[model samples]
Target: MTDIKSYMEEKLLQFEPYMLDRVQLLQAPDSLKEAMAYSLQAGGKRIRPMLLFAALETYGQDAEKGFDAACALEMIHTYSLIHDDLPAMDDDDLRRGKPTNHKVFGEAVAILAGDALLTYAFEMVASSKLYSAEQAVKLISMLAKAAGPSGMVGGQVADMEGEQKALSIEELEYIHHHKTGRLLAFSVMAGAFIGGADEQDTKRLETYARHIGLAFQIRDDILDIEGTEAEIGKPVGSDESNEKSTYPSLLTLEGAKLKLEQELDSAHEALASLNRPAPLLKAFADLIAKRNS
Candidate 1:
């Protein structure tokens, strides 16, 4: 085994300074900057960027080459979380053991902080010196679509609409795939693209990403029901309180576990097709499958 937990921590430590450098206190008001930095620095697993770098390394590319793109991915992700915690969305209070952006900064400033991070992500991508112009354009387009209505935003809308309703498995899958899965897939695919992976390898990695992505969302649902706030860093049972459809709610806890296993198997199958070794990727799949928080 690669000791993936240690590797992940090393990579996170390597990347944090770069991330902070990108999120500088510029001409923007100190308050807005504070709000943006609050969420960015609060820190989660940073799994998306970790996946990007891991996939890049898998393809024999320098992870540093994808640095800007990795940071951009985290920015967009943080922006989404800030917005997701708003009163209009999931209305969350605590995030990663800290008050949400809206809780500290007011909803209006929180919204602007999210907006700032979203726009800054593009700026970082566009300014990437590592990629050629064509590569930059492609990466930018990939990110926009992944973050846009056809992807995460669309999924968010579907999730909100499906709340309080008993959505079919297919409908729930759609929401999970679009809302959470797309970005995760993008995280993996973005690395492949940056590393100039061949068409076959690209498709294979995408398949792995898709499988893991769904599994990630399913694990999230399981955690919401089974994890305590002290462990999860947020309130549990919010799903039932909001009358939201979840994997456990629809498929039963045992059934959801089975689905996660199925997805993990598919992910492994996809990785098996790749010519290169993927110890980190394999470890990541297991981590997502078995994560408690």
Candidate 2:
């Protein structure tokens, strides 16, 4: 094993500083900047950026080359989290063991902060010196589609709509596929372009992305039930309280666990199909499958 945990920490150390630098460098209002920086500072696993870095390094490309795209992706993800924590949404008070953005910054400022980050993400990609103009455009288009109404936004709508109803496995997959999977798949594909992947290799990695994306959500559901508040960074069992259908709700806990195994298997098989080694990506799948927080 490559001690992927240590490698991940090393990449994260490089990533977090660059992410903060970009947010700090923005010409936006001090209040808005503070709110945005606060959430980015409240860290999670940074899995999206890690996935991009893994894809890049798999192709022998430098991870630093994907920093702009990675930061942009993380910004969009953080923006979504801020919005998702609002009173009208998930209504969360705690995030990453700190007060949620809306709780600390007030709802209006938090909203603006999210809007600023979202818009700034596209600008970052467009203006990055690391990528060629063509590469920037492709990353932008992919991100816009991934984050916009037809993707993450649309999935949010589906998730909310399905909250009160019984969702089939297919329907639940649809919600997660867009809400979570779209951005995740983009994380890998963005790295593919930055790393100069051929069409066939790109498709294989995408298959890998797709499988792991669902597995990530399934693990989230499992963790919601089994993980402690200290480990989860928030109250556990919110899904049950919210009356949302989860993998465990739709399938029994054991069934959900089995499905998780299936997804991981498929994900690993996709990596095995790759033309080159994808050790980091494989480690990523294992991490998602077994993560506590």
The top-ranked prediction according to lDDT is 2
Q: What is the C-alpha lDDT profile of model 2 across 40-100, one tens digit per residue?
A: 8897789999999999999999899999999999999999999999999989889888999
Q: What tens-digit string does per-residue lDDT give for candidate 1 at 19-93?
A: 877787357888888888889999678899989988998989877888999889999999999999999988888
Q: Where does model 2 exceed 4 Å of error?
A: none
Error of 1 at 97 (Å): 1.7
* Top candidate when judged by TM-score against the true structure: 2
Computed on alpha carbons, the lDDT of every model, listed in order, comes to 0.90, 0.93
